[model samples]
Target chain A: MPSDALPDDPLPSWHDGRTKRAILDFIARVTKQGGPDYAPPAERIAVFDNDGTLWAEKPVYFQAQFALDEIARKAKENPALARQEPYRSVLAKDLKALTADNHKGLLQTLAVTHANMTTEEFASRVQDWLKTARHPVTKRPYTEMVYQPQLELLALLGKTGFRTFIVSGGGVEFMRVFADKVYGVPPERVVGSSDVVTFRMGKDGKPELYKTAKVEFVDDGPGKPVGINRFIGRRPILAFGNSDGDLQMLQYVTGGAGPRLGLLVHHTDGAREWAYDRKSPVGKLDKALDEAGARGWTVVDMKQDWKEVFPPAP
Target chain B: MPSDALPDDPLPSWHDGRTKRAILDFIARVTKQGGPDYAPPAERIAVFDNDGTLWAEKPVYFQAQFALDEIARKAKENPALARQEPYRSVLAKDLKALTADNHKGLLQTLAVTHANMTTEEFASRVQDWLKTARHPVTKRPYTEMVYQPQLELLALLGKTGFRTFIVSGGGVEFMRVFADKVYGVPPERVVGSSDVVTFRMGKDGKPELYKTAKVEFVDDGPGKPVGINRFIGRRPILAFGNSDGDLQMLQYVTGGAGPRLGLLVHHTDGAREWAYDRKSPVGKLDKALDEAGARGWTVVDMKQDWKEVFPPAP
Candidate 1:
């Protein structure tokens, strides 16, 4: 009876709508005593896609912005990169040219800007960046760009004994620096795209793990399910995403042999947040949006469903 | 002061010895308040090497045995494999011939037997194997061969709020099924060697993940530290291992910023368990054993320090 007792509207930031009602109804059904849909505490797993689902992903991905910043800083050290194809395009801030290359340009930019340092060095650099980096449009700290409604939803899920994870297309180490503070998720619970790392002993007799230029996993679209299987080892009962990059992840979550919930956070508020769908270069939601209705997934229109965004602009 | 309280000889299966005392002392120092070595619950990360360290790994690895069993089962379906070099050697149960071609023979065997199946299929096969398979030398179920002392140690660490993880050279999925029941570690905490996995769509339009034989990581020797850093994201304060395969992990744990405990379990009890070190082809303990004394790692001599080996003849 206590489990069935509806606590106060936990999603206060979410306007009373069909989307909000769907989330509460599912959680209640899954947590109710001796219910057919009840999942055990450990099995109450919820996974979320980070970029567009939890935070703003345009005008470009925050990670791409980080890569751009790193390139500018390192350009002073590696002048040869300034003359290269991708780097030349990157340094010139040529977004159209970079986008025309089919991820070749982005991959090259990341390989140059993200590799060759020890993991500790990389983590420290990310931490330092988080302290100073601001969103280009909002002029707010990147961490402050997280959705307030999603934060409320996350807390509600956690209160109902769900173990949350961030399965993202962004860099794993980069998200780890702020996942705890921004999302209440720990580093080990964050799975994302990762480059290869080589382990070696330092000349000073200590172990050193250095990041290399090799791309190990992409963790987008179909790769999302692969990353989930590799890291979490269990199919999530609930999955939240905003774009086509999370299509397979939602499919995987909702396909399990139990009651499942899949949600798509539709960025439809142009005033509160940037609104672009289907045609956007970054965090495009076309295919998944077309597929969502057939899949029985809840699609939350940001303007209609959410009363506030971005933690009330800090 | 309550945090300093010891739980009535947590390792009762472990005999009273210097190695046992070292474990108790390290735990006490780390859990004690204001003693300089005190670690918070979040920082109390402990990593254990599976296979030879957690369970019995003799006559060959348990995973290798699984691969061999798979080879025989699939041999009837693909007789061409039976005519192949590694398959021929494997079907003949010729270890020497299998080892002669460096790792080429075994890798090819894995590639054939381990590829193209859904992860669920592989997991089901492993579960079926576990139910019926017996160790070549011990004639006991492989699960029964887990060390009682190590199990007690794991419980003790858990009681002290230390989060335990399995970093093994075996397949991550293989260890996951039994790790929860046997070691009380959940699937996500079990980090191990993982091959590439592909995501696909089922006929029902649901996502399906399949295992591939392209070995993404080896998770042995140097790979241990890399796996730890990649999965855990924090340096473990305590590390336990059994062979040279675990040497780098011990080094990584001990090389952290604070006081750490590194342990090596020496397989010296031939009467209770298989005992082969230094010159042994499998789970060799030569270089690590030689370096343990200088490295200040506690080396537990199984013959001398363990009062009981397996779980009280369950």
Candidate 2:
């Protein structure tokens, strides 16, 4: 029995819309061999921005929530933490206080909660958190909150021989914990903002890698392209992103000399997901939204473009 | 009609020796399904050092030659460069001057030649140089001088579903230009020392990644394990290297709690390839050589194991 539908349709979770049409068309044109726009499998590199694009980043980033919880937990044991600058702001649940002055307070908060441990220890902590961490509002495990459309897109691209990577402003260790299980992106393909790690032999004559408080590289806005170039060593043929943080990455990917895709996930669904942008600090989408039309980038409106927000809980 | 020899033998360029036997044995044990030694395809990460391990580094690193040529080219237009600190030493052909105080002089030289360009500009520069640069001794193109035995081994590992990556102390962009063609390792899989890069839109309002003069990550010796951790994010099951620069990487790979293979390529063929170890500043294989036996690592004597050195000149 012949089916009417095409097997090549990769993003089943996405509604039939202009954005979905553009995505499928682009994939088809580039992957057609012996055709004008054919790019071999080696050149089919796709990079994705995490946070808002892959999973939800509504009230705050998932990593930020982890840090907030850590501060709250630590302050319960140490009363003096309530008196500290960053810890005090965090304990007061002051989101605005943390975002003031270009996120300096937020950086300080991250330093307190994330650093000062060995790389292995930090990884273990993140893994443990992922096994149980729940979203603030949704009450679902953070991993379960990943966009169904995006996951379908990732699986589709992988099936078509595209190598997908997660390039985000989140902590590398934090993201690596769930990247493979949720996104099918391995630890190596996941590049993110990171702490300075030093290599040394422990007192027991075994090697050790320690994560220092100092930030080594921040994979955000301008840092996105830098991270892609330094780590991947290739210009991405496709990039999917959201917010002002992904502006440079969109331009970097679409501006390259080939058939490319630059997608901006616009959060317009107020019921299924939060829809604040420009005014909100978390995943702000001002300049990128304004420039999307001019750049010829496809904007996926969460309300109109995605049929579902999160997948059914397993 | 068929040959009696096993078609599974992938190292035809390599003569039968303890090193070859151990390599085959390790691959067999790890890849046998449902066995105690079985490692999934994703876990079979193999890292190989460039320079002495992949190609001849006797005269100097291919990159060092590029810098020398760049210095000479610039000095031709401006004679004053001949009197500059590093330039004067380079002009004097002094190896001791370059390696003195842990290669401070060499770092300065690299800073002058390799930095302050856009990432695209640097890649273009490397690609252009690769097209014309010839080896100082063989007078062959540098790409033509890669070891055939190592190349065959890389292909074999790829066939067995082992992901091969070139992790070298050489410049990331510089090695990436030729890694695909020479070693069959794709650009994304090549990890190396790098200069800092920043992303910004150019005057044309298009994104551009600029390579700064500042040294960011150094992937050598102690830096090797850090590089592996940052880039690959998995302890390699197989590691092949030649110099002491790969010492920490060897320990990092073999020290992991699993079946692993660490092989050192000893340059014993002085006639076919220049042989210098303890006293040679370039690719010094000292402490690693001393510890190879204690760690039960395979040491391939080039004179005995390699039936042929460089591939036939094109």
Candidate 3:
């Protein structure tokens, strides 16, 4: 009898370690036709968390950076607006004051910066920001800070018939502008935090979706599973994340009745990337890290499992 | 140069008429590569209204019937519950009383029946209901009452690079139970009215989504566009419906920046199917019927355009 042909190493950036081997073995099992663990193409669903998992989320989340940039731009246009509490704190780079009162100031700032525009206008603004925004620490385009090893893994999964989705806590419209270009995930496949979008006829008689200040859903922590069910309407067979925000999502995916894999990206390389997980204000991983061990989840050590982080400085 | 070959007619149940011709022409233009009106596979989206467009919705919306059936079953299980106001009206088969006062009684009935269960439990109930439920008048399984012509159109659209979706006012979970088996549309592709679903760890230490009475989103009228944006994140090129509930969706689709088609199924056959439009209590087609003429939407006269309504007796 002929044996199944093995494909070439698809994850070149992934070092040959236990973490990489587990992912490869799981993919092979799910994609092998007529095998006990094989999942059909439609059922081969894989969900990924954004921010720290797929890209670097140091200093703050990139979405927070976008919100801050919007505030700065607004202040530059109207200096008087800068005198407001949140704006003043934002302009002064006061992360402490902005995140004070359980992020009340931050929420106010986001509401002012992100809403009251047509979705088209919001999408255009996001596109423009992506074109010019650079990471404060790395000084590289934020889109370029994505993990190369994750990209290879994503490609391998896609080749093996997995439909990849980004289930992020980032704003849905904000991630949609870059998801397709940066991660090969379409806008519809990006589920995330969202504000109310009201529909009405525009002045030109065309239907327009207006973004409102109302925070409709926050897709983080336990909300991840809610977002998945609301949007995807199916349980994912595999899930990957970097923080406690994804704890429920991992639990939901791995708990499903089938072959499943729950993986986490442990930010362990301080030199190559920021490495505060359990203590980090943004992308904290304490509870999820503990659960990963108890649940036998594949935890990737950034310094060991990955030979490269961001794609070679292109 | 050899001309682009035309595919065989995919809508056999659709009689040769203006309505059918318009559909064929629209499909040809969108699928013709290098043509002026050509759309890529990813951009070739087509949305259909569920209740009156794809299936028969004469006596009442099928979902309403499902709710009524549940009420009847519950009353049978516990006779004292039938003494309740809405339950009394429902058990008496008094739609007039149930629909009076802006459907207050009907709403109460639906709220009680649709909520307070795990999503898995609700889905199982819907599946069981579908297995035994029959149309009040047709005496056929509710699923079998789907229009044969519309099914052919859906198939044609799928074959011609269009990703079809059901944007209905029916409960999303209910539609999803049989969407794949009946409509060939996957669960995720079915977007509709939804209630709030809360997530938590179940008794078995697994994640479970609980359906609540709180309504989250209503995919009707203006909400249709909002639902499209939330789920599809793209403007469809074609939309099909039978009533005013789908007016906004048609406007949104036809108003897109490319070749578009907006079609309405007119229930004009009194013998083969119940005919009600302007003054009907259910699936009212008044406003949309008036707009169809002004907007150049293809209006299918059910008696003339379709050689067959329901699929041939199985």
Number of backbone-clashing residue pairs for each candidate, in the order shown:
0, 0, 0
Residues B175-221, candidate 3: write the lDDT tens digits.
Answer: 99988888899887999999999999889878899999899999999
What is residue B56's positional error in candidate 3, in angstroms? 1.0
Better of 2 and 3 by TM-score: 3
Quote each prediction's TM-score.
0.93, 0.92, 0.95
Better of 2 and 3 by lDDT: 3
**Pairs with backbone N, CA or C atoms under 3 Å apart (clashes), candidate 3:** none
Local accuracy of candidate 3 as per-residue lDDT tens digits, A74-188: 8899999999878899889898998889988888888887999999999998888888999988899999999999998888787778899999998998888888889888877
State the C-alpha lDDT per candidate.
0.87, 0.87, 0.89
Please tell me how candidate 2 rates in CAPRI terms.
Answer: medium
Instruction: In angstroms, give how far residue B228 of model 2 lies from its true place.
Output: 1.0
lDDT of 2 by residue, A1-314 (tens): 01133364567788897889999888888888877888899999999999999999867788878888778877888988899879899888787998899998898888878888778888887777777778879899889989999999998888777999999999888898789989999989999998888888777687878788998889998899889998899998999998999998998999988798899998988999988778878999999999899989999999999988899989
Off by over 4 Å in 1: A1-7, A75-91, A96-108, B1-7, B73-88, B96-105, B203-205
Best-performing candidate as measured by lDDT: 3
lDDT of 1 by residue, A1-314 (tens): 24444456788898997888899889989988699988988899999999989988888888878889888767767887688777788889897887775877877778776898888888887888888988888899989999999998888888888999999998887888889889999888899989888889888888889899888888899999999998889899999999999999999999898899999988888998988889888878998999899989999999999988889654
Better of 2 and 3 by DockQ: 3
Better of 1 and 3 by TM-score: 3
| Fraction of native A-B contacts kept, per candidate | 0.76, 0.81, 0.70
